[model samples]
Structures are given as structure tokens and as C-alpha cells.
Target chain A: MVPVEYYVGLSAILFTIGTLGVLTRRNAIIIFMSIELMLNSANLLFVAFARTFEALSGQIFVFFVMTVAAAEVAVGLALIVAVFRTKDTINIDEVSSLRG
Target chain B: MAPVNLNDLLTILPAVFIVVWACVLLLVDAFAGALGKRLTPWLTALGLVVALVLDVSAAGVQASAFNGMLEVDGFSHAINVLVLGAGLLSFFVSYDYLNRQGIAKGEYYILMLFSISGMMLMGAAADLIVVFLAVELLSIPLYILAAFAQPEPKSEEAGLKYFLLGAFAGGFLLYGVALVYGATASTRLSEIVAAVAAGLENPIFLLLGAALILIGLGFKVAAVPFHMWTPDVYEGAPSSVTAFMAVGAKVGGFAALLRVFIVAFPSLGVDLAPVLTGVVAATLIVGNVAAIAQRNIKRLLAYSSISHAGFILMAIVPYADDAVHRDTAAAALFYLLAFALTSFGAWAVVMTLERAEGKGLELSDYAGLFRKYPALALAMLVFMLSFAGVPPTLGFAGKFFLFRAVLEGGYVGLAVLGVLTSLVSAYYYLRVVVIMFMEEGKPQAAGSPLLNLTTGLTALGTVGLFFFSQPLLDWATNALLRLF
Candidate 1:
């Protein structure tokens, strides 16, 4: 069996990459996907930890995280559509009418 | 085995009622059509009142529900009062503002009720999973609500920015929860505390988890460094939603932050205090100094809101200190009440003066307001003073209590910084007051009875509540949290 440390390191790396994508990407859809990646990294950690401890609670929380992440995506995509409707673009650079 | 019993439902009756009422309002909107637009606000107000009734009637009762997932105690009770009162007041202000904006839909009020339900859950949530869910439950509605003025570029942009940042923050919060669960092998606060007492298997993970959780929550409360989205979002969202979001959202975030940190990680006080100190300091400096340069009134108020979040954060800075957490919680609650009243009044005045197409949003728009409308201008003056924490207002009393809590928590330097920022804030807060009364221009305020009444009542509350402040503080003091 593989060590849990590997899973932890892998998830951390995934989380960092996701964060970088969110910070660097200009497209709203890409940012949305980056958030999904970050959330899934968290899910991987939860499952790995659950297996390590022989506990179902961590796995249960993963289910909650997945369900809520899905809900957030629904609302987030709707917001992206709203932005597109108003500005005719989904680029974060273009959605800057209210900036300081 | 899951702890499924009637007692669990009974303990969370008020929150459950709020969700039930929201779902019912959705159905009401579906069938009632145009009539629902006119009817929903009243029904929403009625639902909040009933929840308030349920909250009050359930007073002096304490219980843990869902096998320690929900904690109903004095602290949660006080939070219920604050959140519901904010919901009711926001409803009063929103009805006219939405109608004026020509976006008066039934779903608006329904969405608010659902968000308010999430807030209520945050105050009472005792498990990590519940906190994660509560944060999303509160936020998802707001992400939609911020963009409620769809096809308005500013509103959609605000919505999208808020969604992206809020979702980014949620990832951190969930990971934090996961780390905490991994360390303690439980998501429940009671068990987590027990695990901490027995000694954490991995203390580094616990510390990292707390810091990440703080980042996630700090975003919601509009703390500095995490506050990049505040001005844009506040400027773009409809004025009424901004009013509600300002007071309603962070109170839940702070509530959950206080509960989780105070209960689960009090043992990590040495590590947490310095971090909180840095956040409080930066939030104060940035929030105050930045407000001085704002040209738009909405952005000005957004910075003011950020600074107030800093002042409230002072109460949480010394969270790891024994027994002081309770005092700090009370102090924060009182400050939140003061903020809600003052901002509700201020925003009502803003909404009254606001013309369609965002015409009256500039700082210059308030010129000669006292000459045209004395009462409204005077109310604005009162609100500005309260926000500046000046004398003869609820804000003064709030600042006094919160500062004392900080001093008690032994954060002397942070307390000094808080005072200095309040001084800096007075300049901008008073600048508006000056423009309203002393300057010269033709200013017309759209006078509506409901908004006028809201402004009048909140101004009175901001001033009058100051004299009777001790009793309010005592009430908050009496609200003992049902945790270690």
C-alpha cells in the first residue's frame, strides 16, 4: 500500500496549481474550472485521510463537499452567463465597469 | 449510529423555520406571478417576524442537536436576534429600492430569506461540515443575489467577481476542515476539543488549518488583504442588496469563526494571536487610509465597512485567551448591532437619493442636502457620526466595549491601532456630513414613507441605544456559549 504522505503531497501540489490557475487565468470559465480543481484536491485529501484513519466521517464530508461544490458551480455558471449577457464577454479583463 | 431524534429538530426550530419559510416563498412566487412581486416582501417580513417570535420564545433554553452538529445557546440566540433583525430591516429598505430599480421580482425576497437561513445556521453550527455547508449556503444565495440585476454590466461583474473570490475562499475553508478532521479524526467541535486536549497527533496541520479557515472567513467579513472585491462588488450590486450584504454576510462569518476557533483550537492560542494581530492591524490601516481617497459614496462605505470589520476583529484577536472569548463575543455582537442600525439608516438615505441609472452615487451628489431635506440629511449625519464611533451614538458604546475587550485580551498595540484608525475614519465620515449640510448644490431626495420610516427608526436606535447600552451588553454577556 502507498504511503499517505504521497497523497498529501499530491493534493497539496494540485491545490497550488489550481490556485495559480485562478490567479493567472483571465477567462471566467477557466477560473471556474480552477476552483473545481482546488475543491477536488481537498476531496482527495479527505478520502486519503479517511482511509488512513479507517473512519467514514472524512469520506462523509467529501460527499458534502462534492454536493456543495456542484451547487456552487450551478450558481457560478449562471453568474458567468449574466456577465456575458451584459458585456458580451466572459474575460475578467472585460468585466471591469465598476473598478476603482 | 446517527443521532436521529425529535430533540434535534426542536433545538434548531428557528433556523428550520427560516428555511421552510423560504421554500414556501419560492412556491408562492411560482404561482402568484405579478401579485407575488407586491406580496412577497410583506410575507418575507412576516416570516422573519415569526422566526423572531420562535427565537424569542425558545429563549432560556439550550440544547445540542444532530449529535453535536448544532449548538443552541445564549450566543446563538443573540446572533439570531441580530441576523433576523437585519433581515427585517433590509426587507423594509429593499422593497422600495427594488421597485424603483424595476427589478422587483418575488425571487428577491425568497433569496434573502434563504440567505438569512444560512446565516442563522452559521451562528449555531457546531461541526466542521456544517460550517462548510453554512458558509456555502449563505454565500451561494448572495452570489446569485449580487447578480440579481442581470444584464446590468456592473451588477453581473460584481456577481462574477464575488463568485470567483468566494469560491476560491471556500476551497481553502474546505481544505482547512479536512486537515482539522484528519488531525482530530472528527468534525464535531466537542470531539475536536477533546482531541486537542489529549494532544494533537499533528499540530502543524491544525495550525495551517486554522490559518486557512481564517483566510476563508476573513474574505467574507471584508478584512484587508482579502478585501480586493469589496469596493467593486458594493459599487455594482443594487444599493438595497449592498445594505443587506454589508451587515448580514459578515456577522455569520464572524459568528462561525468565533465558534470554531474558540471551541476547537483555543489550545493553539499562542500561534493564533500573533496572526490575528497582523490581520487586525492591516485591516485597520488599509481600510481607513484607503477610504480617504474614494470618490464614489458606495466605495467609501465599502471601505468604512472594511474598517469596522477590523474593529470587530479586535474582539477575536485574543480568542485563545481564557474567559476573554466570551467578553469578546459579546463586544462583537454589540458592535454588529450598532453597525447594522447605523448602516441600515445610511443606506436608506443613499437609496432615497439614488436615481435610476446610478445617477446619485458620487460624493458630490450629497451637496446641499440639509437645505433641501433636513430630516434625511440629519439622519445621514447621525449615521456618519455613529460609524466614526463618535459620542451620543450606539457606535460609541460599541467601540468602547470592543476596545475594552481587546485591552482585556492583552492586545495593547492593536487597541492603539484601532483607536488611530477610528480617528482617520472620522475624516471621511465627517466629510460626507459636511457636504450634506455645509456645502451648496440642488439636491433632491426621493421621499418614500417606508424608507423615511426606516431611516428615522434606525437613527433613533443608533442614538437612543447608546444610553441603554449597558443592558444590551449585559444581555450579550449573559449569552454564554455552550462550549469550553
Candidate 2:
């Protein structure tokens, strides 16, 4: 019986924190983790909204988002490993072989 | 539950066929060893051709299928053909480049097919969830392919940067979708439109959601402010992959942009139009001006592609104007087709000339190219001219229609800026031509029949399309008519 506005506000805070982490993090792995946090924040919003409205569609969308997040992690971690192998570092600032 | 039917299955036949074939090819390549790598590109091309044929045959059957989650109509079919055509051309160019670069893995072709199928789905998606899934499906493969040449540090960096930015954009898109669903209580485009029409929700939520969605798509299409990843990604990724990303991603992004905005957010034109107009102007100014300082050919073309996105976005700026809706949509579609062909040709030439470890990308590397390979040089000339919107090319025809559409919609300032920026574009585009024919130095021309074929065909299409543009214009207009 919790109010929907409180859930929405919590999600907004979580989303803002995730965005900041992504923007300020220097490590590629941390940035990837930050992105996951952002997606999960959206998942929280979707679940709360779905519960409030009694709609199955929002929950279904959450499943898709989770699947997509997993797939992204698989690819993103592999890319991080590749970058590490080549550059011997995971810091994004040092991985700057391609600049304008 | 709605009854499942054969028609619904048939509606997604092209994408289904591609996905199945790609999976099969992945397994075959895994087990078959070297032979699979040799045959994968051809097999991938064959699958795309079949999908294209299937798409055309079913083009006239306009129907919403899968409980209205997907729409099989002229608009989707037209965009499918362009996306598939870009895939086919990229395959032709990739075969020899992969062999020369010694990265001819089967996974490359499989990933490409997956990406192409995802793009096709984006064109057909009628629900926001489907759109989100399609975008992820298309993008995930590209992130891997960007780093396909793993031992190379730059390629890995390109992949990492693209993945980070792309995932960030995906988060924005997801939040936007959730907000829209929260406001309207439905994710279906038609249902959402009805909700907006009925005025059941807070306008602020809808407006914020739409802006976020636009930001996400703008990143995919490489519009200004969101375009930082494009130059580095294009310049560092293998040229063939860059070609695919440049055309395929733009087509998918614009397809979703048009469908979502025109269908779901038409009621918010007063709020959205100024925002879109500002994005278009910034994209035009930044994309063109930045290219002038680029010495690397790949980076230069990257900026050019961004500028081209600006022009296409201009066509969509007037989508809410009832009088020019059809014309605007048609012009946008035609411009995508023209840009794809021209970009494929330009990148084909670039791929042919590109050396190991990404050397030979300098503008001076193209010096005296005409003397070594006149046909290749001439093809590059046609592509550059097309990029500059010179007359007697498909680019000119596409730009003419687009400018007229904006003018009809009473955006004279945008139309004028479009023309002026295109003039600025001419300097960089012609600089390549001037270097190719007029300058005197021996530029090494690697002989590859497949690359030559791709270049020759795209050049012919770029010029030939102008003379035979009537049918395409009619097709574009007819395609837009189906949506309404």
C-alpha cells in the first residue's frame, strides 16, 4: 500500500547517482557498472509503476531490460578484457589512442 | 490473449529468416574451421538478398501483426530495403578487406547479419518495447565488431568508447520509455497516441520523455553534442565496420524517430519542433565546421556522415506540419537511400586504400590516385560530388526534395542554413577530389575485384538514381501514405 510518488522519487535519486557515476568514473569497469545501475533504476521505476497500475506490460518490459543488460555486460566485459590486453590498463583516460 | 496467426508470422518473415540464418552460420563457422570463414561473407550476402526479396514481395500487404506490436507496411519495407542494401554492399567490401587484414572470422558475418535483422525490426516495431529491443540487438553486435580486430589497441579503444557512450544512451532511452509508460499506462504507440489525444496525463512527463528519447536517438544517428564517439569510433574501427555503422545505425535511428514522433507525439508539435530545429542547426554547424580541420580521411568522412544526419533531420523537422507531412517523410527516406549509396562508395574506396595498423588514412595518401587507378579515383569523385549535393547525382535529388519540404513547411531559416552549410561541405568534399586528380604523388592502389565492384556499382547508382528518381520518389511518397 505504499504511495507511487515515493517510489518514483527514490528511482529519480538512484538514476541521478548512476548518471554521476558514469560521468565521473575513470575506470571502464566502473563506468560499465554505473550503466547497469542506471538500467536497474529504470527497472525499479517500471516495477513500481506497473504495480500501481496493475499492468503486466511494465513487468514484461522489465524482463526485456534485464535480458538486454545481461547481453550488454557480456559484450562490454569482453571489450574491457580486450582493451586491457592491448593497453594493459582499464583506465579510460589512458586508453586514448584514438582522438581527434 | 489475441489469437496467433500465420499472417503475424509472415509479417516478421524477413527478420526471422535473417536471424535463423545468422545462427546457423555462427554454428557452421565454429565447427567448419577455415572453410567457414571463407564462405561466411558470401552466405551472409545470400541471406540478405533472400530477405530483401521476401521483403519486397510482402511490401504491398499492409497490416499490423503480433497484437499490433509490429507493422508490415510500405514504410517499413522501404527502410528494410535500404538497410539490407547497405548490408549487401558492406559484405562485398568486407570480403577482401578481412582477407587482407587477416581477421576473416565467421563471427563477423554472423554479427553483421544479426545487426541487419535488428535494423529491419526497428523499421517494423510498433511498440516501444520492440523498439528498445531492436536498438539493443543492433547495437550489441556493433560494439563487438568495433573491436573485432582485437590485437590493435585503437580498435579496442573504439569498441570501449562506443560501448560506454552507447550504453549510456540506452539508459536514457529506457528511462524515457518507462516515463512514457508511466504517464500513458501503455507502451503501444497507438494506445499512447490515443491517451495523449484524450489528455489523460501530465504534459510535463510526456515532454521530458520525448526529449530523453530524442537524445538517445540523436546519439545513435550521430547528431551534434552526442556525436563525440563517432569520429573516434569510425576512425579506429575497421573501415568496413565503420561503413556499416554509418549507414545501418542512421537508418534504424531515423526510422524509429519518425515512427515514434509522428505517431505517438504528434500532439506535442509546438513543444518538440523548436527543440528539433535547434538540434538540426547545431548538427549542421558542428558537423561541417569540424570536418574542415580533419586530415584523416576516415575522420573527415565521419564528420561528413554527421552532417548528412543533420540534413535528414531537417527533413523530419516539419513532420508535424499537416500540409508537408507526406513530403517530409518521403524526402527523409529518399535522403537515407542516397546517403547510404554514396557513403558505401566512399568507404569502399577508403577500405581499398587503407593499410595495416590504420596507416594510409591521410588526405595526402590519396595524392595521384587517379593515375594509379582511374576507375577507383573516378568513383571516389562521384561519391565526393554526391556528398556535396552536386547536380546529376542522387544526393542532389534527395536534397532538392528535402529543402522544398522544409520551405513548404515555412522553415525558411532552416532551409537557408541547410543550403549554406552544404556549400561549406563542398570545400572538404572537393579537397579529396582535388587531391585525387590534380595532385601529383604515387598513391598505392591495392587491387581487389570485390571492392572495385562495390565502388563501381554504388557510383553508378549515385548518378543513375538521379535520372530515374521518379519511381523512387513515388515509392517514398506511397510508403509514407500507408502510415496515415
**Highest lDDT among the candidates is held by which one?**
2
TM-score of structure candidate 1? 0.98
Candidates in order, TM-scores: namely 0.98, 0.99
The number of the candidate with the highest DockQ is 2
Candidate 1 per-residue lDDT over residues A1-100, each given as its tens digit: 8999999899999999999999999999999999999999989999999999998878888888899998998899888877787678999987777766
TM-score of candidate 1's chain B against its reference?
A: 0.98
Regions more than 4 Å wrong, model 1: B481-484
Please write out the lDDT profile of model 2 over residues B227-272, one tens digit for every residue. 9999999988999999999999999999999998888888778888
* Model 1, docking class: high
For each candidate in turn, the interface RMSD (Å) is 0.9, 0.7
Candidate RMSDs in order:
1.1, 1.0
